[model samples]
Target chain A: MSPARLFQGGLVVVAAALAVYPFFGTGYGVRALLQLFMWIALAGSWNLISGLTGYVSFGHVAFFGAGAYTAAILITNAGWSWPLACAAAGVAACGLALLIGYPCLRLKGPYFAIAMLGLNEVLRALVSYFEGLTGGGSGLSLPTLQASVPIYYVMGLCAAAVTALTYVIITSRFGLRLMTIREDEVAAEAMGIDTARHKLYAFLLSAVGPGIVGGLAARDQGYIEPISVFPLATTITMIVMVLFGGKGTVWGPVLGAVILFVSQEVVWARFPYVHQLLFGAIIVAVVLLMPRGVLGILQIKYRLPRTV
Target chain B: MNVVITPAMIAQVVISGLLSGTLYAMVALGLALIFGVMRVINIAHGPMLMLGAYVTFFLYSAFGVNPYLTLPASMAVLFVLGMLLERTLVFRVVDAPELSSLLLTFGISIALVNLAQLAFTSDLRAVEFLTGSFVIGPVAVSKPRIVAFAFAAIITAAAFLFLRNTKLGKAIRATSQSRDVAMVCGINVGRIHLITFGFAAALAAAGGTLIAVIVAIQPEMGQIWTFKSFLVIVLGGAGNYPGALVGGMLLGLIEQLASLFLTTQLSEAVAYVLLVLVLLIRPTGILGGRST
Candidate 1:
């Protein structure tokens, strides 16, 4: 078999092992699995828009928070089931992407990023203000289920699906259009690509994974707050992870997310207080020393173009 | 929500907002200048201000120096720090793609905030001021607010003049206009960036000195102030110095007015909503704030 086939086989093996790990694994192992899976999902989603399209989204967590909030409200107030609430929340996040993305994506480069940053702040403030619904700053608690086993698998599945979707999107014609747009929006427009529509499509696609995973994670965690769900650190983490992994490539974000997440978990476990400083230092060093990330060292063909 | 807004109440609110807005504009000048010239969205802008505030706070509490007296010292310290950051970190990615710089500055911000947290322990600190509020016509203004506003106005005017009159200021402007053109004209663009970033940091410290008098200071306050500074510049026009001036006041008035009828949180969201609306309607901003 070719290298591609060999890689595919390896993936299949890992997936099978992951599928059965809960049965034999310790509780700690299962917990770590969920955390790693969550980062992969978040990073992959970010990579779709920011890495591939060159539009750095600083407010992607707004969608995650939106999904989490939606599901939380529905499950708690309306007594909806987890599956129905999560699905609806996923739909809500997509709708939000379309609404915010269409107008915001019209902007180019730094403008788009800063605008999105502002959008996240606005969402957090709104969440805090609407005390009755989002439980204000005190936050809402989901009825704790004794089993987080389902959440772990659901997150794993979502991460896998998102990775697969990224591959599909990047290899397709739509992906090329996005790449072209990223290179130069005006040139892409002149070349007959509907830059706006392609960007919007990328934005919408990216929003879904985070939305779904957010719902699952919220249900599993059993309590959610605006501060926890909509952390500015969340947006920064996703960006750094995808960038660290090799943003445009299929395996890059997943690889980056897992490595960074594990490293962070370890570092935080030992040093604890220094994690933020170290994370910040890591980002600064990466931007200064190696903009291409680990995949760059591997001589990957799908590295992001170095166009500011 | 049903708070009746008499004209007197509006006057008082606007007066205080305008006072704070002046100091905000001072802080924003450094931000607008750095981003306008360097394309570096200094995620560390707020933390820089925090540093300035802390610097002044310690100087005031440890010694008997007035807060205003600490402004120049804060500026000097911050300027050196700014110069160091530019030469070391910012200069590397100054010419790279936008993504790298955005994330890099953000990292600097996180590092600085955490450093502050580690050093200062996330406790809220404020400069103690025993000055009393004085009534002016129908509105009352605090003594510190007036003093802060006076400093803000003076610094702003001085910066405006420096940019127009000084040779180095011209070099900075020339570089902001086009780095290549400035280099071609025998101006050291890199050196100008060093100076500009330093000047920007000093201005941030100056603003911090005044802000320390008016508001409570904390480590996490950096992100919101940085974003708010961005909002001000965006509203006024990003590269326009005068735009920062107008935008700061505009933001303050909008927030105060909104709070008159809406919840405090709702009023805060108004800026973000306006930001989106502005981007949709006029990405260049109302003042046509292009880099040139």
Candidate 2:
């Protein structure tokens, strides 16, 4: 069998293990697995825009909160089913990305990133200031679900789906366009690619996962606050994960998310107070020493093609 | 209800806005100077400012050091920290893509903010100052605010004068214009970079020290200040100090006026709203035309 086939089989086995572990495990184990899958989906989503297109967004929590709030509002006001609300939330988030991305995607380099940062703050303030609609600082809480299992599987499916989508994108013409744009936008435009439109597509594509995940997680947790949902730390976490695993690759985000998220969970469980310090140190070390991330380092060692 | 616009109200608002605006300009100048010369966005800037405030608080409350005297101490401390960070970390990625320095500084920011939380325990601390509200015509003026503003303005002016007139300032200016040209002219561009970062850090610290005189000091306060500083510098233009002053004052006045019509929560977001508009209409910032 080819090595590529073996690698595919390895992925299948990992998925199988993830799928069955909940059944064999206790409730805490399942909850942690759910968190891992959430991180995977979140990090994968971030990798799509920032990793593939090199347009790092500092305000993705805006989309997450948008989705979460949209879902909460729909269910409470319109009597919508939770599942439909989740789907609508995804649409809502995509619409937002489209609206903001059209204007913001025109900015190049750090300006684009910081503009997104400003957008997040604007959205958060808007949500709270319109207290009559969003419950203001008190935030919105949805009806509780008895089982966490459904969210686990939904999040797992999302993680799997995003990974598969990333693989497909990596192999597709659209994905090549994205990486090319990242490499050199001026040259890409010179070569006839619509850099603005493609970036918007990537940004929109990346947003849906976080949107859906936020909706599901909000419902499962039975509560949502603007501060909790739209924390700036979420953006930092996703960026660091993608950067750590190796950006711009199909496998990089997954690798980065699993290692970093799992380790963080472990550290948080053991030494909650020191986790942030640890996380910050890791970020410094990674950017300073292992900037290529784990996969990048491995690729460099073996002299592998960056795209593949 | 067309409530009559009173001249006294206008005087009050103008005084309050200008007072806060000077502090904003002081902080923004530091950020602008570093970005102007180094081309690195120091995300850790807010935390550094917080440190300055914290230093002032501890000194004033603990040892009875004059709050004004904390300015020099804060500057000295931040200068050392800045030099050390520049030599060790920032210079490592001085030529890498812009994202590298951003990420590096972001990491440092997270580390600093969290460590501050751990050390200070998130309690709100304010420097105790004797207060008297002095009236000028129809307006009530805060004495501490007036004094802090004056002190901050003096420091900012001294900094500008130094940059414009001094021999070392010329070297730094030459480096900002073109690092290679500065090198060719035997300016020791590396040393200038180090000194410029240290000086910028000191400026930011001085801003923090002055702010400690009037406002509440806390660990998390840095985030908003950092955001404001960035908005100011970006508005004025990336490397334009005077532009930062204008942008800072503009932001302060806008926020003050906006609070009259909008909720303070909403008003707090005005900087970002203006930022988005500026980026869309004039990405060079309000005064950044043709500079980039």
Candidate 3:
């Protein structure tokens, strides 16, 4: 087999192992693996828009929060099931992306980032203000469900599906257009790539994974709150993970999420208080030093295939 | 929500809003200055203010120093911190893509806020040096707010005067207009960038010190202030100095008036909503001629 085929086979083997390992693993192991999958999905989704298009969203947590709330409300108030509520959550998140993205995409670079930051605050405030629906800052609780196993399986699938989607997109002409836009948007537009439409598609696609993941995670936890669901730290962590793994690449975000999440778990277990501080320091060092990320270095130094 | 708004009530809200607006302008001054001169958004702007507030809080609580007297201390501390950050981190990314600087500053902010949390324990601290509200005709004003407003006005005036009259200020202005041309004209652009960052930080420190007198200060408080400052700069226009002052006041007034009809939560959200709307409607801001 070619190296690409070998790599693809390796991924399938890993996925198969992950899908079955929970059956033989401890509850704690399953729980941890579930969270790892969640982060991979979130990071992968973020990479779709930010990594590929260079539009760093400082407030992507808003979509996650929106999705969580939507799913929680549907399950609690409307008597919807977990799977259906999560699907509706994805749809709701897409609608929000459309509303916020149209206006926000007009602003380029840092302005877009800052506006998204503002959007997160706006959504948080709105969620809190409408105390009737979201339970305000006190948060909302879902009906107790013994659905951890199901959530784990779905999250694992999401992680795998999002990675597969990224790989497909990276090899497609549409992905080329996105990379072009990232390089020089004006040049991309001049080349007759519908930058706006392509960007919107990417933005909408990016919103779905987080939406579904948020719903799954919320159901797993059995509780949801504005602060818990929409923390700035969540956005920063996803961004750092993508940057760490290798942004704009198929496997980069997945690698980043896995390594960072495990390290974060270890750090949290050992030094909970200083982990955030260390995380911040790491972000600073990353930007200053290896901004191209681990994969970027590997690709340049060892001539690794970009697709893998 | 059904409370009637009489003229006196309106007067009180407006007067209080304007008082708070001065402090808003004070916080925004440094951000406007840095962006205007360097075109680099300082994401760490809020943490610098938080540091200032903490400095003032410690001085007042530990040494029994008057809160007003601690302003210079906070400003000086922030000034050095700003210079060091700019020289070490910001200087490397000054000419890089705008995203690099923003991310760098964001990292700096995270580190600073977390460092503060480790040191200060996230306790909310305030200096109630001047208390009680005095009535003036129909409206009443808090003494701390009046003092804060006065200091804000004085500092803003001084900043305006310095930018208008000093040779160094002229160099800074020239650099902001066109860095290459300014460099050709014998202005040290590197030094100006350093000074501008420090100067902006010092301004934020002053704003924070004044803020400590009026409200509770905590490590995480800087994020909201940073957002407010960004809104002010965007509303006033990027790279427009005087516009920042106006934008700050406008945001303050809008927030205060919004509270009359909306819940406190919605009112807080109003600032962000306004930020998005302003960004979409007028990216250049009212007085801003520089393209964002």
Using lDDT as the measure, the top candidate is 3
For candidate 3, write residues B1-292 as lDDT tens digits.
4889899888887888888888888789898888878878888898899999999999999999999999899999999999999999999888876666777888888889989999999878878899998888988898898999999999988988898889988888888889999999999999999999999999999988998988899898888888889888888888778888889889878888988898877888888778778867888787867622
Runs off by more than 4 Å, candidate 2 = A20-24, A302-308, B1-4, B290-292
Per-residue C-alpha lDDT of model 2 across residues A155-182, encoded as one tens digit per residue: 8998888888898998899999998898
Cα deviation in Å at residue A55, candidate 3?
A: 1.5
- How high is the CA lDDT of each candidate model? 0.84, 0.82, 0.87
* Candidate 1 TM-score on chain B: 0.95
- TM-score of model 2 (first chain only): 0.93
lDDT per residue for candidate 3 within A221-252, as digits (tens), equals 99988889999889889988988898899888
What lDDT tens digits, residue by residue, belong to model 1 across residues B127-216? 987478888788888888899988898998899889889998888888887888889999988888899899999988898888798788
Ranking under lDDT, best-scoring first? 3, 1, 2
Share of reference contacts kept by candidate 3: 0.57
Write the residue-wise lDDT of candidate 2 on B175-268 in tens digits.
8788888899999988998998898888888878888877889887787777788888777777766788888788878777776667778887
Better of 1 and 2 by TM-score: 1
Candidate 1 Cα errors over 4 Å, as ranges = A300-308, B289-292
lDDT of 1: 0.84
